[model samples]
Target: MEISRSLAISSWIAMAIVLSIAPAGCFYLPGVAPADFQKKDPLMVKVNKLTSIKTQLPYSYYSLPYCKPTTIIDSAENLGEVLRGDRIENSPYVFEMREPEMCHIVCKITLNEKEVKDLKEKIEDEYRVNMILDNLPLVVPIKRLDQESSTFYQHGFYVGAKDQYSESKDAKYFINNHLSFLVKYHKDVEMDLARIVGFEVKPFSVKHDYEGEWMEGRTRLTTCDPHAKQTVLSSDSPQEVEDKKDIIFTYDIEFQESDVKWASRWDTYLLMNDDQIHWFSIVNSVMIVLFLSGMVAMIMLRTLYRDISKYNQLETQEEAQEETGWKLVHGDVFRPPANSDLLCVYVGTGVQFFGMLLVTMVFAVLGFLSPSNRGGLMTAMLLLWVFMGIFAGYSSSRLYKMFKGSEWKKITLRTAFVFPATVFVIFFVLNALIWRQKSSGAVPFTTMFALVLLWFCISVPLVFVGSYIGFKKPALEDPVKTNKIPRQIPEQAWYMNPIFSILIGGILPFGAVFIELFFILTSIWLNQFYYIFGFLFLVFIILIVTCAEITIVLCYFQLCSEDYLWWWRSYMTSGSSALYLFLYATFYFFTKLEITKPVSGILYFGYMFIASYAFFVLTGTIGFYACFWFTRLIYSSVKID
Candidate 1:
């Protein structure tokens, strides 16, 4: 026990030292370096090469307006890219709509005999198709030309994938209709670039007056003509273009700029609310913390002090009579919970979760996990979780030993497999559903297999090693020895009822995080950006402190009521926050989300369930350990013969 304590202390000190120095040597802090910020001078668009029906590449064909495909320029990978940043390519097509010569293009398609023969040979052995729609990935990196320094592109949109492309049975209909773009010009003239915000495969049938006649002859692509002066499309002034074989597909252009500045582009959504919600959340959390802290202080400084002093001076019968509340239950306070092994496992897993979060946050604060590097956050989180499995094994084994558990091997195995397996199974089921829907987001079979390998080869082995070390150490010595038979728990007051207490305890923690929760939910569901990790990290610390104080305070009351079964109750008390979280997610969905599709709803809830379950584990573990230490500290303070 002494050796274990020493090792634990040493490890923490070492980690603290490393965390303090590592950030300085590694990445520069956000907003600290002015030279790193540079504007992207000219926005570029690249077209990906052509793909086939056999290949699943999203956009494979290169698109050139008037210039050749070889004119597209690829960009270099830079460090200052935004989260989910794209590699920009110089666009072959450029327009100066303010000129007297309005650009017009009438494209004609001609089949290359040699290339057609090669395509036939490639698809000949497989189930064949005469013609496939050649999709294009127009990579448009949006850089605010106004801002000279901030170059990170936070958002971009793709054009394709509608019923026009998918449902168009004929090849000619698909080509003529699907190749389209929506042009939006602002009324203000300062905005140099017109917003080609979206592309679509609109039915060519919408353009022609003949309802049933399939236009098969020729297609036209054009811009605003110098003579026509066509600019904006409305109900009164609709699009009127020549539909002959060599006619132009007219695109009207105008430019308008708004009040949105480039400096706040990344956080435009957050700027909308003006930090009012964030302040409210912080204030709410502070109030809860103050209330919990006061309650705990009273219990520690006043109530526990009086009881301990009185117990020490128990010389008369009256003095002994006063030792009737929490002091009376000290003998059974350290008693192992029912299903001691499972409880230990939970505690261990919770420790792992805590460690993972701490390390990940530290890295994030150091700027190692930035939006400039795509998937860095998730990748870091996943790796940390896996490597932190040792904590789960060590914590669970130590607690189980303290509980006088003998089945160490069985406990460790279950500790490694149980919770993770449940999560993996749910994930796999959800992935299968996604695969059935043919969603691009589905995890491939190889990736799933790789994940399984990572779990077995890395996480499970770490758990085993940690369990071995933990089990070798002596069990923690309890201040008050357990009695042969368990103490009978007395009935409690209405507020002290487990269900009521658990429900109430959860509300404060949930309230502390609900406002931030809204922003997080918006990022996930509404496709908004979340870059406020510093604030999030602050909230996370507050949450941990709140859970601990609340659980410790409640655990004191429960013990005073002669309810010695605090092992699970302490866990459930704070863990119940997950229930509130899940409920809030449901509320957010119904109130904030306009998801009409049943599949979308199912996907949202299914993932949410997994997330909530993990949260429950993390919070519960924290509460239990806090109360455990609190119980020990108070009991150990009083002299017991």
Candidate 2:
């Protein structure tokens, strides 16, 4: 038996090792296939969404009438990509490896009133054009003054500049029709191949006078000749947005060989912080944990130990009657609270959220869901949430049985649909709002249907299976027996009041993570990259500890006050952090964000509401479990007979 157990443990450890390292190899982005290229190979440049910080909305590249390929083919998008408003499509711009071209004309087209209006609105909104080449995003490089090296980059360039103050009433819109692209490649000396490490663009607007007529197959431009170099002019003519204005799209390509290898290519794109802010956040969280740790230590070692010792030593019935505090309510401490059904559902949903977040963070820390993988992070989160339905079912069903509830199937159904249904309704409404605006941010019907299918077919069935297994198992053995009649609690102090205490309980947990939360919000609302998974994972652990300790501390006080309503209070104490989170989000909106439109404001608040709800579930569950374990251990250690 010992040998078999040892072998089983060894096998499990080996399997875990494999699982941890498996996703590292799949870190590359899914849409693009070519990681390295040989000489003379054709390279494709795909256009992505046009994003804006001022508007905080993303529009498809083809939505505007600049130029298009003969056949527009959209790159395959994952579920996360579809939800995130990524619309990647093929473009007329193409390039050759190790080949440079001078001033090439892509296409020319005449714009009508509607197209002009759309372009002007986007330009005014400060939308930037995004493009991708070999899974590397295109950036506009800023030249340095001293070394003449391109170190800083704007991820994407503006579609055009709007001169609101200029005297050029000729047109407020000066579209950036000319692009100069510089591709940096790293040579693989052993394989005799090259990998594209950088894709940079310099955009400009110029009114060019062409020589030949623009046709479907034949085109010529004297201003942008292949032989001579054409540079950006100090004074260029504006491309007006009047009724029949023609826009010519042109580009120049140059290749530069670099010493940086392919593996470290993304080092340029990842946001390198000063580290002082992150360290401060960590240190602040650690201080909260240490304070809570000291308080808990005193409670367990000095206070609770003394109370239990006195109660156990008492032999006379009169001596037992003289006992006070938590020992007096041993019989009523395990009594189930009212509205236990809702508590069960919340706990179960929290379990599901917990499992999903834990797995997602683990995968992220292993570098599987990095920025290189585009939408892989959200894709993994959704799939993990779906699969974790089993845990939700088991947790809720077990708790329901522990409460002596008989209707297992009803609880399971509620567990499967409650949180997801609420979120789905809110999401559908938001999608409808976006659809009215005709934005690509709205999820397509097919994708929405797929989400529904996953919920009903996969998640619901797994929840049912887990509920069945949980119901068949025996109910959890309580450390103390419940009394027939509930104990009437005396009036509590203002500090122990439910509302005040719950709110106070949440502050420490929020303080632990509010700093990191700013970066997360910025990465989402602003068009910036965030790759601080290690720091994020650490903050998450601290938040968990903070939530758990705060809840336990508060639960001890509540029980000591002879209040047996510990079940929901424990959940609420930690769950209340969401209130602070939402409030912080509101503060962030009024102060940080530039969203002016009513619809945009609605969208931001709507999404933040959902995020806060999930946080409530996640944190509330942590507190509940921590209090539960604390109560059981303290109650069990005492001689309750």
Candidate 3:
């Protein structure tokens, strides 16, 4: 029995190893054939029109191969190296026409025959010519005739650098030889070619820092090109060349005819879009929203109306009867909830998040946050969040005042600090870990400083100003007067219990968004593109409606149960969806991700906690205010004597 168990465990381990590495070798399988395996289609280079421009940020592997400052004075004359959320539509590089054809290779050497021969004798390193087009890396192919392996391509060459991962030295060479890269046509792949649409070199910032400048150029390549320099320029001054500050880059492009259409290049972005599953999610969400809306409408039009009419008529008769149901708790309903100060703080943060989401969606819908621009969406969100601090201050202060809480200063301070402070601390810790790893994705210290500046100089001040304005305004008046003593709560049904109700109430909101959540996770973790903001915006609206309607319905039920402690419960009921989001993230990590490192797992959960908390704030706020308004409207309509 022990031997059999050991064998079974060994087999499982072996299978896990194979599965982990399977994706890397999948392309080499016999079933995976070349593009032109059955039919011959001549390769062509097709140039695409430049859709957007972006600043190039240089990255190095594990902080190896240190970059040097460029001495090219004329380069980067008009370009800004550091990107402070600037659009590059006003770039110096000009692209007139885009077409695909065979490209002609041009090589001009100013070296004498003896010098060239001597240089060739000393050349020991394989020089790789790499191009950046649309911020995408293009590399020269090193051919291998192995039939068992898929065609592997390399983009960069080693220069006296050992393998950081293995700690093993591959090759060593002296940098004493003259180097030149020749443009060559790639004939291995059919129907796929590169056309040099345009090329421009300028001094740009490396790693989002202005401390070091890199003289890098991007050559726009399309899958089609026949060699002709219709508009090409190269700065080949002898002085600049002697300084070794300038590099002359030439490109040869070829195109291959393929069954794949160019229009469908972005088809991957359609993740769940335009599919039956997508429509099903949409239909499911709509049904829930409609059901809740109908419930709310019925209560407002029928039950509440009858209750209010009966209560008013009771007052006109000599034998006046007492009220029951939601009206019985009217006195304590307007009474400030326990810990109103904390609730006010949360309300403020929720308002801020609400504004941030609205502005971000607007910008995304307007195409200002296109995925092609890289980091544009995040940049926009951060900026909008900073500016929307005033909303947080205003909303929190007003709510605190409505609650008759005199600690306006404390409310405003916590509103500004509590959640945002937690987020920033977590971000800093994560960033520190990334920096320790020396990963290129690590946010630089300077960038962190800038963020701090934006927060304090802009967001914080705005919050204060908003708080002042909100405090100066009159406090919100409640429809019913508060009794000196609180009303005794009655026993409730199991369904009306806070824990049970919150658990049940959270499910619908989670259901409304789980499908979309999957696609969003794919985009984030799988590196897939997500550009269908139209559908996203629609889903956002659906989520809002779902939260509001569900919260209102749930609040009504709770009030009907004579539980006036709906302040925190209302918020938690809707915000509980974020708990499910965290659960989904855990499931996704175990099933979808092959992350084997302990550090990665920890980081994943850490960041996920921050995300879940923020989501809780956003959704919880929505439910609270929705219920608040509903309570106010219903109570105000009734005549109390």
Clashing pairs in 2: none
The C-alpha stretches of model 2 lying farther than 4 A from their native spots are 1-34, 143-151, 166-171, 212-222, 229-235
Model 3 lDDT at residue 411: 81
Q: What TM-score goes with each of the models? A: 0.70, 0.93, 0.66
Instruction: List per-candidate RMSD values in Å.
Output: 10.3, 4.1, 17.4
lDDT of each: 0.60, 0.85, 0.59
Highest TM-score model number? 2
Order of candidate numbers by lDDT, starting with the best: 2, 1, 3
Query: Worst lDDT window (10 residues) for model 1?
Result: 127-136
What lDDT does model 2 reach?
0.85
Query: Can you tell me which runs of candidate 3 are displaced by over 4 Å?
Result: 1-132, 135-252, 255-276, 316-321
**Candidate 3 residue-wise lDDT, 36-142, digit = tens:** 21223332211111110110112232112122122211111111112221121121111222223222222222444453332222222122222333332333334
Error of 1 at 292 (Å): 0.9
Angstrom error of the Cα, residue 294, model 2: value is: 1.4
Tens digit of lDDT per residue, candidate 1, span 1-641? 64356446534643453334232312335643311111222222343323222222112123211233345565432221111122334433333432322223323223345433333322221211111111112222345589775443222232211233433443121112112232222222463433222221221211212124334433222222234543322222222211222211322223233343333222332333336667778888888899989999999999999988978877877666667888888788887778888888888888888988887787777666644333456655665677777788888999888888888889999999989999999888877776675533466676677678868988898788788888998999998888878888877889999999999888888888888988888776554456667777888988999999999988998888988888999999999999999999999888877665566677788989998998899999989989989999989988665
Error of 3 at 400 (Å): 0.8
Error of 3 at 353 (Å): 0.6
TM for candidate 2 is 0.93
Clashes of 3: 25
Which has the greatest lDDT?
2
